[model samples]
Target: MNDLQWYRLYSDSEPIVEKELLNKLLSNGALAKFALVRHNGEYKAMLYVNGKRINGPALPEPLTTPNGEVTHWMGNKPGVGLTTSEAEMIIQAVTDRIERAR
Candidate 1:
């Protein structure tokens, strides 16, 4: 068993948004395949990609449903995150490598 790398994501959106973000990250090699795990109402999405565990970012805002209904309660502090440009840089680098490899 290997320890997963932890990434903290902050957003004022629904879990589905977080999930979508995770999916994007996975497709971009920022993450691998993952599992959605919940404990005490806290959702922890984990994945092992390239011998690294990429833990999905946590949601900071309350999660709402597609109908705009609140589904889950987010914590008071959603915390800060790396700039989008920084994340995109990583994504692009990985995507480039993947493209070249393919």
Candidate 2:
């Protein structure tokens, strides 16, 4: 997947907040800045540049909760919402969902 492409979204309405989110995620190497354009009224999720979405929002389960959130795998700690086996299942689910949605 070395040839992987990236996707990103930004809106002036959320400058401060979006910038903070981008900074935090970037530090962890999950994504990077690719393009910045005006999309004032468009709500878009960053889709796969190759037209494929990642296997999961795979968002951390606890983070998916109210306001508590954490990203990244710490030493031996895996983030919420996925275990080794669960990740495989999520991978399948994500692919299935995206395929149907598209």
Candidate 3:
């Protein structure tokens, strides 16, 4: 799918650039900033945007997106997106678990 919407959370940190962990945090909403990352003397495009919370804390992973694809260049790679499917899934899972418990 088109990943909910545009995206959120941008960063060039090793954790973000080294691993593509957006999907994990996408469920858990967040507020962050990102910039061009220089790793191993090489520049990768864009990595990923963390997200608002909708599930348990995301586990650590070696995540990072390669090549910062630019659809609209506003200078200095930065973007945002909103994915829906994953959010919905988290919501359902949480609700079901709660109802079953009650």
The candidate that wins on lDDT is 1
Candidate 1 has an lDDT of 0.34
Model 3 per-residue lDDT tens digits across residues 3-73 = 44323222222323432322422224644322232333333323334432122122111114423331221
Model 2 TM-score, 2 decimals: 0.24
Number of clashes recorded per candidate: 0, 0, 30
Better of 1 and 2 by TM-score: 1
Candidate 3: where is the Cα deviation over 4 Å? 1-82
Error of 1 at 73 (Å): 18
Regions more than 4 Å wrong, model 2: 1-78
Report the error of model 1 at residue 47, Å. Answer: 10
For model 2 the local lDDT of residue 36 reads: 17
- Model 1 clashes, total count: 0
In candidate 1, where is summed lDDT lowest over 10 consecutive residues?
12-21
User: How much is 3 displaced in model 1, in angstroms?
Assistant: 27
Candidate 3 residue 84 Cα shift, in angstroms, is 0.9
Q: Is candidate 1 or candidate 3 better by lDDT?
A: 1
Per-residue lDDT tens digits for candidate 2, residues 42-61, read: 32222122222322232223
Q: How many backbone clashes are present in model 2?
A: 0
